[model samples]
Each structure stands twice: as structure tokens, then as C-alpha cells.
Target: MATDELPDRIAEIFNGSTIFITGASGFVGKALIEKLLRLTNLRKIYLLLREKKGKAPVDRMQDIFNNVLYDKIKSLKPHALSKCTAIQGDVSQINLGISQEDREKLKNEVDFIFHSAATTRFDDTLKYAVIMNTRGTMYMLRLAEECKKLKLFVHVSTAYAFPREKILYEKAYEPIADPQQVLSSLNWIKDEAMQEMQDKILGDIPNAYTFSKSLAEALVYEKAGKIPVIIGRPAVASFKLTSSEFINHELATEHVRPSPFAMMDCRLPVFVTFCLLRYPQLKCLSLCLRMHIEIY
Candidate 1:
């Protein structure tokens, strides 16, 4: 469908549903929230946020809402504020770090879940990547399993999960190694030692990002048979074009890639990931994911 038709179509899907969004502060997350508010009569949107540099989630959300792109949405829906609910938590924790009461509330009220939280830094350490990208996914899955009324669970993976693969495909691939195993074995190792062992663990994988992300995909497959699950994979450089010289750079997993795409855990799935979530029952959503992976 054309971009102009997407909002109206999406609006129809989420007419009265409540949604829980992770990575709501990131670029795509912000866009997703804006589009929903601008186009749909979404009942509520719960944002999963972690306290950052002493800033609160409400403050952070306000900053995003005050952005210029949201102006149309704000004006179109004067009560847009009522649709946004900020839930303080980290995706890396159990139950997304939400309190027991909040977890119960979400399980009861939320109809959709969008797992877009991931660290997108190229040089991120193995420990950090595994925790946020791999384990964080595990946590989200667990949370979704607990939700009594979940319609769909959308996990943002990457298209470059195989950073070294030149020509990719639409099908999903399994990880060379188990993510949890790698994480567990590295638990006792020192940071420096872990860094040094990165090559050994990754084998032919290009970086820790793709390696862990591959494992995250495996996690979804492992869990999907139990619920309705779909994965989306978006090719590299799906967003605004930079300069020509930077075009290839933006197309690959290189410098200038946003944090959301830079890190592992997120795969490059397709846009349909959101559609499955619109199904209105407990379902698993994954998109092979998207990012800019360069080819020589």
C-alpha cells in the first residue's frame, strides 16, 4: 500500500486497542507512536522506559511529543496525551522491569506489544549486547507469555543479522551457537577476557551484533510454535538518505547507523510485523529486521 493509505489502514486495525511499545524513545519507535496517534483511535499506548541520566520517562516522552513531527498528531487529537502511558522499566529485565502491579495491569489491559528496544552501537561490548539484545528478548517473550490478552508480540530484528552475508534472502536462519549458552559461559569471564574471546565465540560471524541477533531469532522460533508469531526483516538504510558517499555507508552496518539498528537483538524483519500484532489476540511477531549492511 502507498504511504498515504497506510495510516488509514492502520487506524482501522488499532481502532480501540491498547498497545505496549518498547524503544518508544528511539527514532522508529517515535515514528510508530506518532503514526498511531495521528491515524488511529488507539485506546492507550504504554511505553517501556528506563531511567536515563536522571531524566524521567514522562519528561522524555514529553520531549518526543513536543517534536515537530508530532505537531499534526497533537493538533488532530487534542487528547493525545491521554493515549500515552509511560511505564518505567528496562527491556533487559524480567517482566521488563515493571512492578508486579504494573505487570498485572499490562497483562490485563494491553492488546499489543512492540519490542523495538535494542542497543545499536557498533562497538558495543559482548556483555552489553547479550544483555540488551539477546536476554532482553528473552525477558520480553516471558512477559508476553504472561499477558492474558496479548493480541500480538512484535519483535524488531534486523535484516543484517548475517552481517557478513552478501546476498540475503527472505527466509530466516538459525544461529551458529546458542545465545544463552554463549552468555552463560561468558558470565565468569572478565571483561577483557570476554572481549578477547569475541572472535572465538563469533566464529565466522562479522560482529557480536549479528551473532547475538541470530540467536534472538532462534529464540523466537523456539517460542513461536506456542503462539501466533511473525518476524520482519528490513534491508539496510531504510530511512532518510544521507549523502551519496554515505549512501553505501548507511546501507551497511557501519558508522552513522542509529543505536536501534547498530546493536544486536533487533533483526531486519518486514513492515508486516505490525500487521500481525493488529490481530487482537496473543501472537508472536518478528521481522527478519532491517538495517544498512554494506556489500563490497
Candidate 2:
């Protein structure tokens, strides 16, 4: 749906809510933030971003808002732009590296959360992937647990996380391995040793990224406790070079569907299509999930 055309159900769910998000600089994260900022009346959105390369998280957030995705809101719903705040944090760290003040504020005020940060590189080592994807998720869930008003926690994974399955199902399935144990073992292992043992550890899995993501989802299911958790597994889609190229690419394939909030609780999957490149002010879709989601 376009920003001006969000459904009542979605609007109602989001109205006046404070949302905390991880991986706001990534493809799906940008899309999700843009959609929420423009499509609804929200209280606030706190995006967790680590200070890196000498750029502060707030500076990086300004660059994100300068995107085409926020163009319409900048001109029309200008106040919406002000609702986005950047918090300095790293998911790979304990407590996500959030300051004590910020952490306490989020615990008391956040109404929703989205965890999208993960190590998706095929060449990434198991040790690194576990830290970012598996332990990162565990950390986010812990934070979500503290939120006094949390309604939902959305965890983004990949469709190919379970590569060995002939049919991809949407329910909680047993993870390939226990996430807690794997995370604990990272203390003594080097990246090289993990890489050498990757095949033996992953077995039928294709890559460290997918394998870690599966374990992350398992952690969410097993540890979310009272918080409603939705696992989103989006189908694989390559980055398109241009709008016409993206359209042409889409025409070349038919399996992809636009789905937003498909896995909210146990609700049936729903497709919600929105374009990532149409915004003239934005230059990247690296944070976009692009709606091809299967929620568990």
C-alpha cells in the first residue's frame, strides 16, 4: 500500500504507538520505517544504529531521512519526519550497547519492536554469524521483554533459512541446532576453526547466514515468553538496478508476493506491495524486505 493508502486495520494498530527497531539502515528496515512514518500517525520511532566509520548514528539517521521514501512526508506530513530518532547501539553487543537512560525509556514507552539486523553474508564465518544473527536476536528479545506496553515483536528471517525442506511451512519447527549452546561455544572458538567446521556443523544448510537466521528464529519462538512474536521469512530477491529493470525483473518472475505483517500472531498471510525505488530522494533499498514475507 502507498503511504496515503494504508488500511484501517494497520492504521489502528500503529496509531499513537512508539516503535523501536533494529537494522534501520538495511533494506527492509528502511521500507518498514518509511511505511510506518508516512502511512500512520505514530508517537515515535527509535531506530537502533551503531556509530561507525566516524559517522554518528544521528548523522546516519539524517541521511536515511533524506531518502526518497520520506520525500512525500517531508513535503506533506512534515511532522512525521521529526518522529524518527536514532539510538546508538550494536546488536552484536550485550544489551545492544544501548545507554542505560535510553534503555529504561524504551522499556517504559515502546509499544512495538522490529528486529531486522542479521549477518546475511554467505562468506561470513559461523562465529560472526552467531554473534550477530543468533545472539543479536536473543538480545533484542530480552529488550522486548522489558517493554511495559509491547504489543508485538517482529523478527525478520529468510525463506531459504531452511534450505533442506521440500515445502516451507509457517509454524515453529525445530531449529537445526540449539541457539543457546552454539552462542555459548563462541567463547573459545576462532573464526577459522568455525569456518573449517562449518560443513560439519551446518550439515545440509547452505551458508552461515541462513543457518544462523534459522537458529535466531528458533530462539525467538522458544524465548519470547509473553511477548507476541512473529517470524517473517521473505523470499529471495536480488537488488534491482533501476525502476524499469526492477519491473522487468518482476515480470520475469511470478512467485514473489507483496506481504506486510503476514505473520502477526497466527493470522493468515497477507500480501502488501510497496515500491522501494519510486521515492526520488532515496538511493538505496538495502534495508527493504520488499513485502515477499511468510510470517510464522
Candidate 3:
């Protein structure tokens, strides 16, 4: 559907807006691209893609669109994908490894950015995780700063970033460590040494993934400055909608919806959670075990 044909608020807001997205090959990125193509008539969608294995970035992007996730968009708007252009880049590298030509084009054309590139593996080495998640975020922020027409920068974070907190709020909480200090440590600390000290470094955080993400959030808080930014912390994203039979059977007998607090336990397989919260300046969407909490 065209943006003009859709009278919804979201479609109107995004109409004619040019967007740049990192992690365009990931699950969340693919889903976001599909939705924008299907629901909104955005002018352009620039995808930051890094070559992996033996394939090139453009080939990887083609494979991403070939997935079943985009089947709906293909049927709805066959030409919608023409708006998407793949930019060769690696988020873990300096300046996101984007060429000067591409960088200049992005700065001039992009109106919004979604920085969703990061390693989500729990077992990632501390050094690798910091370089990818924490430092990568800092680099993306610098790029955002250069975009003269940029309106909003959305940082995709994880809900488990602050595992120590009992009630995770929408606002930015203190990070586990100073991101810059941690990044600097990587220069002197070898990968093996970093691995040995991983547990000690993680402290309350369960894994390097969450720990690095926490530090990335802190970096954003410190460096966002005048940039219009919003942080979204989403929990485990299960692509398959298959429900646990045990949860269904138990809930059927009780005849009541699960409590929102059930999510805190992290034991239940299925439940809906609700919490009253307010984030005046920041917008966040927390999706945990089917629980959706949106604070704006």
C-alpha cells in the first residue's frame, strides 16, 4: 500500500523518510524491513551489510529478502524492495567500515537510523563482545552525529542488559563498567586473558552478551548529547510461534491470564506482563516472553 493511501499515523510519519539500518540480515532487522515495506511508503531504505563466509554483502542481502519472512511483502508490493540499497560495511570496525563515498551519501540522504548491529551470543568472548557491541555503538553514534538531516536514532538493545535489576525500567540504568575503559583494556589484554577474566568482569551479568550490551547502553547515555535517540531493549526473540503445551494446559484450567510479575521469575514459558511506567523523553519497547511494555 502507498503511504498516501494509508491514513494511519505511523505511515504518515514515515512517508518520504529515508532510513538507514544496520544488521539488516538479522532477524529483527529483516522483520523491521518487511514491515516498513508492507505498511509504509518510505523514500529509501539503506541496509548496512557486511560480507560473511564467502558471499558478498549484496548476495547476503538477496538471500535475506529471499526468506519466507518477506513473502508477505513480495505479494503485497513487488516493487517495494527497489527502495532498499545495500551498503557494504562492518559495524565492528572503525567508521562502521563504510567507504567515504557511501558515508557521504548516507549523511546527505538518511533521515533516520536504526543501529541494531551486535553479537547476541551469550558465550561470545569479552573482548569480541565489547568490540562489537560497545565500541560499534560508539562508532554508529559518531556517524549519526554527522547526518545533518537525521531525525531519530534507534538503538536496539537487550532487556537482559541489566540482569541484576529486579524490576527493569525503561530508563537508562548505570552500566556495569565504563565503556571507554573497557574498550581501552582490550588493547593490552589479550583474548586469552580476557577469556580468563570473563566471569570476574561480567560480575552480576550472566554472560558477555548482556555485559557488553549494558556497557553499550551507558556509552549511548554518555555520548548521545543532542542527538535524538531512543533505546529499545527486547528480550529473547523467538521466530517460531509454537506455544508450550504445558503453559496452555495450566492456564486453561486456571481460566485467568498470567501475572505480569511472572516474567521476573523467568521460569514460566508463556505469560502476559504489564507495568505502569513513564519515559517522557525516551521511547522503549520491552518484549519479554510475550510481554510487551511500551513507555514513551
TM-score: model 3 vs. ground truth? 0.80
Off by over 4 Å in 2: 1-7, 237-296
Give residue 159's lDDT in candidate 1 (0 to 100). Answer: 78
TM-score of each: 0.79, 0.79, 0.80
State model 2's lDDT.
Answer: 0.72
Give the winner by TM-score: 2 or 3: 3
Runs in model 1 lying further than 4 Å from the true structure: 1-9, 164-166, 237-296
Residue-wise C-alpha lDDT for candidate 2, range 180-236, written one tens digit per residue: 789888987777887789889988788889889888878887754566666667775
On TM-score, the candidate that comes out on top is 3
lDDT of 1 by residue, 124-212 (tens): 88777888888888888888888887766777778777666576665556676877787676568888998888888777777777777
Return the lDDT, model 2, position 16: 93
lDDT of each: 0.70, 0.72, 0.74
lDDT of 3 by residue, 57-149 (tens): 889988888865566578889999889999999988887899999999999998878888899987888888999999899999888989999
For model 2, state the Cα shift of residue 290 in Å.
7.8
Clashes of each: 50, 14, 0
Residue 101 of model 3: what lDDT?
99
Most accurate candidate by lDDT: 3
Where does candidate 3 stray beyond 4 Å?
1-6, 239-296
TM-score-wise, the better of 1 and 3 is 3
